[model samples]
Each structure stands twice: as structure tokens, then as C-alpha cells.
Target: MDVTSDEVEMETAPVSADELVEAMRQAADDAGFDLEPEQLEVARRLGSLAVGEASVPAHLYLWGAAGRGKTWLLDAYFQALPTERKRRVHFHSFFRALHRSIHEHRTAAAEAARATGEPGAGARAAAGAVANAVDRAVEDLLDEVDLVLFDEFHVHDPGDGTLMIRLLEALFSRDVSLITSSNYPPSGLLPDPVYHHIFEPGIAVIEANMTVVELAGDTDHRRSSAVQRRQGFSRGTWMLTGQEADDELADLGLPRPDAADAVTMAISGHEFRASAARGGVLWFTSAELLERPTSVGDYLAWAAEYDRWVLDALPAPEHLTREARARFVHLIDALCDLDVELHVIAATDRETFMTAETLGRGGFARDAFRTRSRLALLRTVG
Candidate 1:
């Protein structure tokens, strides 16, 4: 566990992944996580990877149940790594960016072919141009990062699955080291029966390029029975409709979100315009946060960075479309996972909010239940 300054500062020298994991474990323990025995063993395996002790594959792919600390471990490992050219990304956001890049590249390639008087350069030239564009995009995007780590890896879109094959090939060819955490095994990716084959090649790439490590566990540590009561969940009696909610927030020393100005946030190259953000506290209306096509990855990124969040005009699930409600569930899950202090201005009293007619409506019903549970812990302020 006693890593020297040289080990921590190994400029251009490769440090064993086990050493990084060991350091990460110590840091997590110091920060109060009860280090499970299996977690330590897995860290050792990951460290073995950093040192080339593993013979088959060099990259790492860790998978387990939700809330099993796969993200937590990757976070720690990413922080502990001394490598300067390392990047950590939420997998969903990464794919979103990748999709955009692919489109942009294909468009540019088409434009280039047209400029050369080959508007009908035919399929072969067009294909060659696209391939070159993909190469350029990948090179430019990852020009700075030698190691790329992805959290919450999943393949739900067939488009993303197809793109993954090319992206992974490019990264592997460049010898970019990889570390990923996922809920599903590579074989379990894109479980949609109809379009799963689109990702088969991508899955094969993962199998060939990474050493899959399973972190088996049952309990979700984030929601453990013995979870320590945390600060920052607060509620009020009055519906968060008018001036009353502002008064309540002022009483709790939080900013008045209505009067506060808006700020734009760019996550994974996508623009997210927030209604109010101040002093590391971000504020949003229910519509702004949920009605849009926001994913948990965006929330996760924000939660990791911001210490406080204020969500005003949080509507009951009944008031929202199914998609909006599902997104709300995802937001709560990310906040709980990161243990971020959340201040909400709910439309109704705490009890009514939990028992709304739309409570158990969607595929996210379980997430809704957990969100309600976490919300219950918030202090009622009015």
C-alpha cells in the first residue's frame, strides 16, 4: 500500500493497474467506504492488468449489478492513475458524442467528395471518404487521452452498436488503454432480440480487446440498510407553485431559483441550458430537467461536480408524460448514487408526492420507489 512518490509520478512510465487499484482502495477506505473483501480482490486483478500480469487481454471490463460500486471503483482508479492522458466518461454520454461525431464526419466526407466534382464518386469513394473521416474524428477526439474509462457501459441503440465496432477498432489500433464498468456482460449488451445482431461485432471486439472482470454482489451499497443519514434533503408544506416556495428556500439559506438567472451547461458536447446555477448549486424546473431527452449520464456528471442542487416545480409523475417521468426517476437515481445534497420544491406535501396515482406506473417503477425512499429522508422545512 506504500506507493512512493516515484510511483505516483511515473511520467511516461506504466504503473501496474493493481498498484493503482490498491491506492484507490486505501483512498476509498479513508473516505469511509467499508471495503468489501471481493472489491479488494478485484482491485488486485485490475492491478495485475496494469502490469501486464494478465496474459490474454490488457484492457479491463468490469461488470456487476447496479449500485455495486463498479462506478465508484472506476472513479477511484481514474483519480489514482498518474497517467496524464487519461479520460473518464459516462458511457451513455460517450455514445451520444460518438453518434454526433459520426454524423458530422459522414457529412464532411460527402461534402469533400462533392467539392472534387465527384458528387457521384459512387459508393466505393464515399465509403473510403467516410472511413478516413472516422479515422480523423477518432484521432482528433482522443488525441490527448491515452487511457479511456467508461462508466455504466450499455448498448441499447443499434446505431451505437454499429459505431462501437469502428470506434473500438480505432482505439485498439491506436493502443489506447481502456477501463469500463457495466451492469451487463458484453454478451448481454443490446438485449433487444430484433437488433442485437447489430452489436454482435462490437461485442466481439470487446471480448477480444478487454479482460472482463465480474464484481459479484447482491446488496446495493448506496441503499444499504445501514446508510448514514446525509445532509441536504429538505421539504416544505406549501406547494412549490408561487412565492411561498421562494420564502421557504430563503429560510433554508438556498438561492431563490425564480429570481436567479439561467446558465448553460455543455455536457459531452451537448448543450444543456439550466435555469439557475450559483455557488455550485444548480437549479432546474421539472420540465427543463425531465421533459428534454436528458439521460442519467448527464445527471451523473452534474452530480459528481456540484455539491448542491435545487429543483423547483417538481411535478407529480401523473402530470408528466411517461418519458418525462422516467427521466425524473433517472435523475433521482443518479443523485442518490452520488449522494448529492438535493433540495426540491415539490408541488405537493411529502406524503402526497410519494403516493401519487402515477407512482408505480412505468418500467421505472422500482426506481420511483427508491426515489421516494430517498426523498423521505429529506427534512421537511415548512
Candidate 2:
């Protein structure tokens, strides 16, 4: 849970948002994607801002329902920007890196205090190191970047509340133009009534500095008959018993490991038994994935090593323990972000599998819609 994978900030050329949208239409014409009017209008506005033809606050925060093309619009805009000093990072990856960097910085400072000594991820350290560590983390992430785009931005974890505000302060202070794609608006982040206050300051920063845009729509057009491709996660299967998935696995030369010979695997720093394991392939029961104190960082670590993941005996979320159910939702988010395969053998039908939530007052309901939308990228069979 200590390490997470992130897209390295890219070094590339820039174009205008409107031009990028035109290119998208041309390339994806086969999918009948004309570039929705709502998104196009947003693109023009972004282009205007890029050219100084329009003035907004500090940046943009595009949010609304899942499948509303918030990400698509942001991605296109990223490619179209006029400066080469832009970087795009998945927020979770940045978060993990920031955490690791902070710990390292803190430990170093504490060690300096040791002889002066230090406190670290693997070492002993001091409390004054915390503030200095955060400062260093912000500097490391921002560097010379003039613009940054953070995808899937949300604040569900109260632990991230203060960190989020601090990071935002650094970005705004450095005049880093920001764009984010999220299912939640600034007000909706960290929606748990108990924890929402923790993020209120960060929310205020977002509301004050970013132009909030809503891109609402019905229907996930990506799952339309014309667009869904047979690739990546789509190459995976969801079925009753995983028989079809097994055959495909074997046919592709990575046969599933037998349950009797469960394989012990190391994720980040923890050890757990997989239902089976082979070359870049791993199998697990839903319990194996969800029942423990595993985190999204752990999921990402394994994903970096394995190309395929098979999850069996996936029960209804309502039937799972609160912690277990939350892990499942996090697992989905992690997998969706990676270029890996997920073959699910559900204990219930897809309807129930998709709709079920952990029985609780506060959980991952906010993430469910995004989870289902991304899961649609994969092919499902009854």
C-alpha cells in the first residue's frame, strides 16, 4: 500500500483544443462519434482561455455524471494546449508518490535531527519533518510545469483532506493552470457528512480558483455497438463460473492455476495467497481481493507485474463486510486505471453484481457509478 503507479508527466508538443477535437472526430469516425455538442462547446471555451481570448479563474474543474465525456474533453484539451510545459497525471498515482516522498523527506529531516536523526518509511524520525516534507513533495510534483491535468479527482478519504488543500495551495500559488475530471463537484467531494468538513478548505480552493463546468448526459455512448472494441479489459470476460474465461486463458497460453495449489504473492510489502498464478497471470477469489486490509496501492503493484487477473466467487456487495466491500470498489477503480485484464466469476447475476453496495450509511456509493461506467468498457456475458 506504500507504492503506487502513476503516468510519468509527459514531454510533448501542444495544439489547440478545437483542433484536437476535430482530429478526434476524424479518427473515430467509424464509431460515429461526432464529438458531442456539449463537449465541443466546452472545448471552444478552453481554447479561448488557452489563447487569452477569454479569462476565467485559475483553471477548470469539469464534473458531472459518469460517461458524460469529462475525461474525453479534458484529454483532448491536454493534447491541444499551446505550451509544451503541461503534464497530465492520474491523481491517485500522484497521491501515492507524494505520500512516499513526504515520508522519505520527513525521515531524512528526522535523521538530520538524529545526529540530529530522522523518521522515515523504514526509519525513525521527528514531527517537525512533516511540514517540511509536504513542502518538498509539492515542489517535486510541480517543478516547472505550467499546466497539470489530474484525472479522476475526488476526496473520499478523510486522511487526504489536509494533503489535498496543501497541494492545491501549492498549485495555485505557482500559477499552475489546472484541469480535473471527476464524478463529484467541489461540493460533492468527501461527501461523508462526518468527513466532509475535512475537505471543506480544499473545496473552497477549488471553488475559488477553478471554473466549474457541468457536462451532464444520459447513456454511456462508449458501450454502443459501434465503439466498443475487443481489446485490453474488453478481452476479459464476466460469467457465471469462469469456464469461458478459463478456456480463453489456456488458449492464450497462460492456463489458470488450480485452487489446490494457491500461490503466495507479494503485493507491495504484504503477503497473500492467490487462487492460482502463472506467467503474468493471477487468480483470486473475491474474498482474496476484498477480505483483507489491502489498498488501491497494493492492487496497483500487482497490476504492474501481472497482465491478467481472474477474480472468482464474487458475491453481492451487500453480503460483504464493510471493509471487504470497500476494497472491492477500490479494486475496480484500480483495475480500470491499468492496462490489465479482469475476468470475473460472479456469485450472482450481472444486474445484482453491478448494483449491490456494502450495507452501510457511508461507503463507496459515490464511486459506484464511475465503477460501472468503466466496467462497461469490458465485455460481459450471462
Compared with the true structure, what per-residue lDDT tens digits does model 2 show for residues 104-221? 7777766676573233522345466556667776666666666677888888899887888877887777756777888888999998898998899899999988889888667666
- Candidate 1: tens digits of C-alpha lDDT, residues 154-201: 766686677677878987776567788877889988877799888998
How well does candidate 1 score on lDDT at residue 26?
Answer: 89
Model 2, residue 117: displacement in angstroms?
A: 9.0
User: What is the TM-score of each predicted model, taking all chains together?
Assistant: 0.68, 0.85
Worst 10 residues of 2 by lDDT: 1-10
The ten-residue window of minimal lDDT in model 1 covers 1-10
Query: Between which residue pairs do clashes occur in model 1?
Result: 17-47, 17-50, 18-47
- What is candidate 2's local distance difference test score? 0.70
Where does model 1 exceed 4 Å of error? 1-22, 51-57, 79-85, 90-93, 96-100, 115-133, 140-146, 225-248, 251-282, 292-309, 329-342, 347-362, 365-382
lDDT of 2 at 279: 75
lDDT agreement with native, every candidate: 0.66, 0.70
